[model samples]
Every structure is written in C-alpha cells, then in structure tokens.
Target: MSEATADVRDAQLAERKRVAAATVDTHRDALIALSHRIHENPELGFEEHQASAWAAEYLQNEGFAVELGVGKLPTAFRAELRTGPAGGPTIAILAEYDALAGLGHACGHNVICTSALGAAVAAARALDGLPARIVCIGTPAEETGGGKIILIENGLFDDVDAAMMVHPGTEHLMVRGALACITLTVRFHGKSAHAAGAPERGVNALDALVTMYNSIGLLRQHVKDDVRIHGIFTKAGDAPNVVPHLTEAVYYVRARSHTYVREVLEKVVACADAGARATGCTMEYRTDRMYRERRNNHAMAALYQQNLESFGEHASQPPTHGGVGSSDIGNVSLVCPTIHPYVAMAPLGTAGHSPEFREAARGEAGDRALVLAAKCMAMTVVDLAADPSRLAAAKAEFAAAQQAEAAE
Candidate 1:
C-alpha cells in the first residue's frame, strides 16, 4: 500500500475507534445495570439461566441475531452482528457468567460477560463499511464445566478469525497464562462390618482413600514446578465407629502444558490403583474434560494493550512467574488467534474467588473496569477490522505458535 493511502486508512481507523469508544460511553448505564443484575443473581456452572437470558435479550434488543442454548449447552448462547457483507473476517467476543460455588461473582465474571456485551454492541455501531462480523458468545460454566472446550468440539470457533476477552483482576495485564487442567473422581468400595466386634472381617475403604491421597502427596514432590494436584474427600465415611464401606474423593490436576498434565495425570492415577491393590478394595475413577493452557497471541495482546493505554490505564508489567490458573478460553485460543487480557477491578493482592473479590465485582471499581474494558476491547476490534495488516500479523503469529506446538 502507498504511504498516503496507508495514512488515510490509519486516519479512518482512528475515527472508527473514537466512535466505538463513544458508543461504549453511550451504553454505559445499560451495561452497568446488566453487570449489577448478574452480580445480584448468583448462579453456578451450567445453571446460569437468568444471567444468560438477560445477556441474550440485551443483544437481541441491539439488533444482534441471538440464539440461546448454543453448543447444546442449556445456558450457553451466541449473538452475532455483521458490520458488512458475508465472507468477511469474524471476531468473537467471549462471555463467561458462571459464579463460584458459595461465593458469588468472586471471579468478576459479571464484569467479563457484560464487558463483552458492551464491546460487541459498540464495535458493531462504530464500523463504517468494514467487512467484519462481531460475535458475542455466552459461554456458561467457566467455574466448573468447560463450556468453551465443548463449543470448540461443536465447531463454534471453526470460522472465527480471532477471539478476545478481558478478565477482571487486581491489575491490568496484557498477558497472563493459565495451566491446562483436568478433574478426577475416584471411588473405593469395600465390605462393611462392625468396627468394635468384627473389625477383622471389614475392609476399610477410608484406608484406601487415605493411602491414595498420601501417595499423591509424595507424587507431587517428583512433578514439575508448575504441576498442581489437589483434592478433597467428598465421602470419607458415614460414622467414625462403623467400618466404612465406601469412600470417594475428587481431585484437580494441572500443569503448564496439556501434554505434560496428561503425563502427570497418569502417574497420579497409578497411585490410586496402587492403593486399591494394597487395601483389597475395588476402585473406579473418571476424569472430566480437559481445560487447555492459554496461548495468548502477543500480536493481538499488544494491540489490546495499546488500546487500553489510550484510556490512560496502563497495564502492569507482565508477571514472570507463579500467578496462574486454568480456563476454558485456552481451548478456544488453540483454534484461532486469541487474547485474554486483564482489567483492574480490585486492589492488588485481593484473592480471587473470595468474598472480597465478590464485593469488588459489584462495587464502583468493578463498574469502572467493566466500562473501560468494554471501550478498550471495542477499539481493539476496530484495529482488527480496519487494518488488514494488523489482522495478518495476528494470524501469522498464531500460525507459528500452532506449528511449534504440532512439531513438539
């Protein structure tokens, strides 16, 4: 492209970004109301019926073609708005609405989902003959169910050019990685007998569970630094006096990479098998869907950070080590160019999934973060839609990352 034409295109893109930011400001009140409403009504994974419906309704009102129960998930939905004709590049803005058990909105998903809604509507309004399609996907059950992972299997992201979402955190960060994770449930069955009178005839299932737990504790020492294995006893025993016939436990295994996590998971399960063999108790186990590690597209993240800084909200230096968790968005990232940045919502050091974080999600800081994140994300979408070169760079980066993973 000629320098003068490039300059003109840049100017046009700047104007669209301004319009998108203004559009976000225009819907500030409605967006806040939606965030507050979802905050007030706390729902668990796969059960965010009210939250999902409210989000879908709002998008429908904004002229997005809304579809509820997407990917065969009851609380999942997809809303689409095309700024131009068909065959244009598609950008997906993902929304997660599941609340933590016992603690409501502690993860600031209220901000996550509402910000996405605002960004989609604002971007759609700002586009001027841009050949792009903006899609807002209501991904439910981030707290438990792997909704995005299922969506990927359902081919929801097959046509997507890029995906972006902002999570509410203690500080703004353009790149935060998540561990790949999987859940395991184990049950042990043994013969019940009187503890005091006929203890010899009884096979203690609790002993087997305890043996497995201890074995895992030892296994943890041999694993990599990023590997995390934790579990809780759901059914240890009915009573302390009686010989327990059944015991069950649930565990979460996580690692920096999916392949390594699977390798570690096998070792962890072998411990359980050893426990069963040693205690003469029959054992059975099952694992839930895997949540892949995040692949943050640096090209896209730089654009998001640039847009975020334009609002005078600079992101903190990216963390070098330690602070990481798993999310289903990682699965989406593996399929297309994706960025999951963080917008500050609470003071630094405030623990996520806690009561303090829950309150912050509905407080003034939370509201500010929601609006600002929406504006930033909307402007970032403008960057992708207006400049083909920017999108090309992001796609190139994503392709390289995929190729590297495949070679590994």
Candidate 2:
C-alpha cells in the first residue's frame, strides 16, 4: 500500500496498544470482582440468573447491545459491539459461569467467565479503526445441559466467523482434543413382596443392580484403553424387611471420538441388559444427547500462543499421547474456528474437581491466570482484526478439519 496508508496503520496500532495498557487495571478489578461474586453465590448449570445478569449489565454499560434469555435458556445471553465499517468478520467470545451441583465453583467457571468478559472489554477498547464485530455469549448449563450445543442448534453461532474461550486448569496449555461423552440413566423394575410373608414371591431389584455393576466391571477389560465407563447407584433398596421393587443408576461413557463413544455405549448397555435378564427384572435405559469431542483450530491456537509468549508465558505443547477430559466447547469447535486453551490456575499435576484444586482456584495463582488469559485472548483478537490473512487461514483450517471429520 501507499506510505500514507502504512503510516496511518502504524499510528492506529500504537493507539490500540495504548488503550490496552491504560485499561488493564480497570478490567482487572472488574474481573476480580466478577469472579468473587459468582464464586460466593455459586449457581448450578442453567440456573445462573444472578451471574448472567451481572455479565449482561457489565457488557451493556460498556456499549454492547445486550440480549438476555437466548436459546430458550433463562441464563443465556448475547452481547454485541460493532466497530468501523460494516460487513466485517464477527468474532465471538464465549463465557461460561455455571457451577457444579454440590462443589460450587470447584471447576473454576468463575475464572472462565471473568476472563472472557475481560477479553471482550479489552478488545472493544483497543479496536481503534479495525472493522469487526465483537460478541460476548453468556452460555449457561455447561456443567450439565451442554448449553453451547443447544445454542448452536438454535443458530446463535451461525453469523460468527470464529469463537474463543479459555479454561482454567492446573497448567497453561493448548489442548488438542477431548474425549466425546454420553450421559445415561438406567432403571430396573421387579415385583415387591412382604419379606416376612414370602421371600420367594418377590423379585429383588437390588440383585439386578449388583449384577449390572459386576457385569460392567468385567466388561471394562474388553473396552479400549482410552474409553471410560463410570456410574453411581442413584437408588437401591429402601428398607431391610421390604423386598426392593426398583433400583436406578446414572452412568457416563466416554471415548476418544463420538463414533467410538457410540460403540462403547452399546457394549455397556448390553451389560446392563444382561443383568436384567439374569435377575428376571425389566430394564430401561436412556442416553442423553451425545457430546462431540473437541477439534482445536491450530491456526487460532498458535496465534494465542504467540500473544502469550509476548507476555512472558510459555504456551504448552500438545500431548504426545494419552487423552484429556471432555467439554461441550468441543461441540462448538465442530462448526466454528475455536480455541479452548488452558490457563494455569493451580500447580502442574494438580487434578481438577477436587478440594485442593478448588482452593487453588481462589488463590493468587488463579488470579494470575485470569489476567494472563484475558490479555492473551484480547491480543489474539487484535491480531485477527488487523491481519486479514490470519483470519482467512483460520477459516480455511476450520473448513479442512470439518471436511476430514465428515469423511471419517
């Protein structure tokens, strides 16, 4: 381009950096407060009313046009900010704030939500003359209902060019993929009779449950090493003198991919069926909608890695072997250019969903993760907005990956 144009671009970038630096303290305080507030009032799954409202209000006050209750979920929301000329790419920043049932913010969703909000705000303030649309999506029920999958089905991500979100983990790293999973519930029914009157007249449902558990334990040896099957007896016999008439269990089946998960699920279900047959009881099973494994966009991930490196943090290398956990964000990656990098909240090797990790999530390390993740995400957005070729590369990579997955 012309010298004048180059000079103008340089000036714009300088201003963007200035704005980013100036607003860091302000955004940091807001993020810290947001994290604490959500942590204190921990709401489960799709019931994050107060957390959702807080995010919506924060974005609305910062000039985004906010819409609440998107995708038939009370806690879901969408906030948009447009800049420069129209017809530009729309980039989405997703925030998840749902807590675990009894563990509260043990999964560090409070950190995830605040970091995303901070990233959006930083990007908005640094846009300068870039032509782009910023959308902050408040997705609830990620802990249970898979909110993003429902939102995707409802066309919320249809207009977006790319999406991004960060997860807090024990180490800072870009995960290449996650296992696909399915949730299931199993029930057993049998005839009930008074124990004192006649033990032979009653069929024991508890026996069926025990048999099923043993069957699954034996089936594990034949399954793939990467596959995981776990369950809990939700219901068992009520009283000692009464012949139990019903028993129930909730199970989760996971595999390296969605196709493999289906295969593993069928085998597990057959085991349960065998239990029912052997115990002379009726069996019923239901599988919740399957969750697809994550497909990370390498191009996007690399960009974020570069930004993190600039801040003196080393981006983690992808694993050479073994599999990680599953996430609903995996579903979103199937349809859009996405990044689900992990920001360190605890020390390396610290496991998630435990009391130790939960304690670390609210400490100094977690706070650092909040700031670093926000900065990395915001800088990546800047790179995308200023470099057309990078955006094109991201989209091209996403398309190729989708095509490969379809062929498989």
Candidate 3:
C-alpha cells in the first residue's frame, strides 16, 4: 500500500479509537443497566419480546435502522448502520438475550446481549470514514431452538461478509469450537392397572424408561471420547401402588461435529427403541427442529483475538484435549464466517447454568466482561471494515471448512 493510503487508514483508525474511548463511560453505564434489566426480566427462547424490543429501540436511538421481526420469530430483529461507499464489506455483530429455564441469567446471556449492543453502538459511531456496513442482529432462543440457524435459513446472513459474538464463560478468551448437539424427546406408553390386583395385566412404562437409561449408559463406553449422551426423566410412575401408563424423557446427544452428532443420535434412538421392545411398551421419539455442532473459524477468531490483545486482553489457547459444550452458533459457522469467543465474567470453574454463575452475572466481574467484550468486538468490526484482505481470508477459510465437512 502507498504511504498516503497508509496514513489515511491510520488517521481513520486513530479517530475511531478516540471516539470509542470517549464514549466508553457512557456506553459502560448503559450496558450495565441493560444487563441488569435483562437479568431481572429473564425470558426464555423465542419469547423474549421485551429483550428484543429494548435492544431494537436502543440501537435505533443510536442511529441504526432497526427492522423488527426478521424471521418467523417474534423476538428476532436486525439493526443496520452504513458508512462511506455502498460497496464496502458488511460485518455482522450478533446479539443473543434468551435466558435459561428457572435459572434466569445463569448462562450470562444478559452479559452477552449488552456487550454486543455496546460494541455495535461504538462501531456505528466510529465508522465515519471507514468503508463498511455495520449490522447488529438480535437473535432469539439460543437456549432452546437454534435461532441463528433459523435466521440463516431465512437468508438473513446471505449478504453478510462476517459475523461475531462474545459469550460470557469462566474465562476471557476465544473458544475455538463447540460440540454439535441434537435434542430429542422419548415417550413410552403401556396399559395401566392396579399393581397388587392385576400386575400381570399392566405393562410398566417406568421400567422401559429405566431400561433406556441403562442402555444409554452402556452405549457410552463404545462411543468416541468427544461424544456425550445425557438425559433426564421428565415423566415417571406417579404412585408405587399403580402401574404407570406413560413415561417420557428428554435427551441431548452431542458430538464433535455434525456428522458424528447425527450418528450418535441414531444410536441413542436405537437404545430407546430397544428399551421399549424389551419392556413390551410402545415408544415414540422425536428430534427437535434444530441441531448444531462445533464451529471453529480460525481466521475470524484470530482477528478477534488480535483486537482483544489491542485492548490489553489475551485470547486463551486451545486445550490439548477435551472440549466445551454445544451452541446454536455452531450452525451459523456452517453457513458463513463466524466467531463465538468467550469473555470471562466469572472465576474459573464457575460452571454455567448454576446459581453461582447467575449471581456473577450481576456483580463487578460481569461488568468488566461487558466492557472488555464490547471494546474487543467494536475493534474487530473496525478491523474487518478497514481491511478487505482479512475478510477475503476469513471467507476462504469458511468455505474450505464447509467443503471439508461435506467431504467427510
């Protein structure tokens, strides 16, 4: 690049940094308040009307053109801001605000939503002379249905060049990938009768459930180390004196990749079927509408890592063995360049979905994560906007990974 062009780019970067730094205090307070509000309200997936509306309104106030109800989901929306020429690359900042069942913000989604919002606002204000389009997509139902998968199917991310989101975990760093997973419900039905009077005439559905659980436990030893099969009995016998007529369970089957997840899910279903056959009870199983697996976008992840480093934070190195849980964002990686990095909000070993993590979501540590995540995300957006080669590289990596997965 010519010296003149380099100088201009440097000037733009400096100006963006200045604007971001100047507004940090104001944005910080807004983010903290937003996080607390969402944490207190805590709605479940696909039903986060208040969370979605508040995010849209906040961005609209910050000069973004907000579009409510992007897909069939009532709580899903998109906010867009454009700068410079129209031909610039479009970078997407993803926001998720859904809460866990019964735990409110235990998974720290409250932090994720506010952080993404703060980042987008900073990006919008700083992109005065940059050649890029900024888009903040409000995706619902990360805890239940894969909202991003639905949005992708609806062609929401078709034209977007790259996407990024930060998740609050036990540590502050990027997660290279997440496990692919499928949720399923299994039901068994049998004839009910008085246990002491006509035990022979009644088929016990609870026995079928116990048999299924045992079968899965035995099957686990044969699967790959990366695979996980876990379930909970949602329904069982009501009273010991009566033979239960019906029973049900919910299961989550996970694998390192989509193909493996599909394979393991089939085996799990077979186990459930065997249990039903052994117990002489009719059984039915249904998989949830969405399935997602691990997503490792190295190029985009590295870019975000570098941006984080620029703000005095370092990305965590991948472990030599073992992997984290699954996420719907895994599905998004299959379609486009995407990064789901982890920003530390709680201390190490503070597990997600627990009461401790939920408490941490509102404390000082959570507030720090919110600010750091926002800065890193905003800076990464600037990086993507200022450099075209990086975007090309990210897209190339994404295509290669998708092709490799398809071939496998």
Clash counts per candidate, in order, are: 0, 0, 3
lDDT of each: 0.93, 0.86, 0.85
TM-score of each: 0.98, 0.93, 0.93
Show the colliding residue pairs in model 2: none
Per-residue CA lDDT of candidate 1, range 69-162, in tens?
9898999999999898766689999999999888889999999999999999999998857788999999988878999988888978888999
Judged by lDDT relative to the true structure, which candidate is superior, 2 or 3? 2
Candidate 1 accuracy as TM-score:
0.98
The TM-score of candidate 2 is: 0.93
What local lDDT does model 3 show for residue 92? 89
In terms of lDDT, the poorest run of 10 residues in model 2 is: 16-25
- The TM-score of candidate 3 is 0.93
Task: State which candidate has the highest lDDT.
Answer: 1
Clashes of 2: 0
Comparing 1 and 3 on lDDT, the stronger one: 1
List per-candidate RMSD values in Å.
1.0, 2.3, 2.0
lDDT of 3 at 297: 76
**Tens digits of per-residue lDDT for model 2 on 1-408?**
899998997677656755654565578877888888888899998889999999999999989999999988889999999867776788899999998877888888888898888888888778856689989999998879999989998999999898999989876787566889999899999878887888899988888889989999998899888888999999998988888899999999998889999998888888889879988999999998778888888899998897778778887777876757788898898889999999978888877887777777677777878888888888778767777778899999999988887899
Model 2 residue 190 CA deviation in Å: 0.8
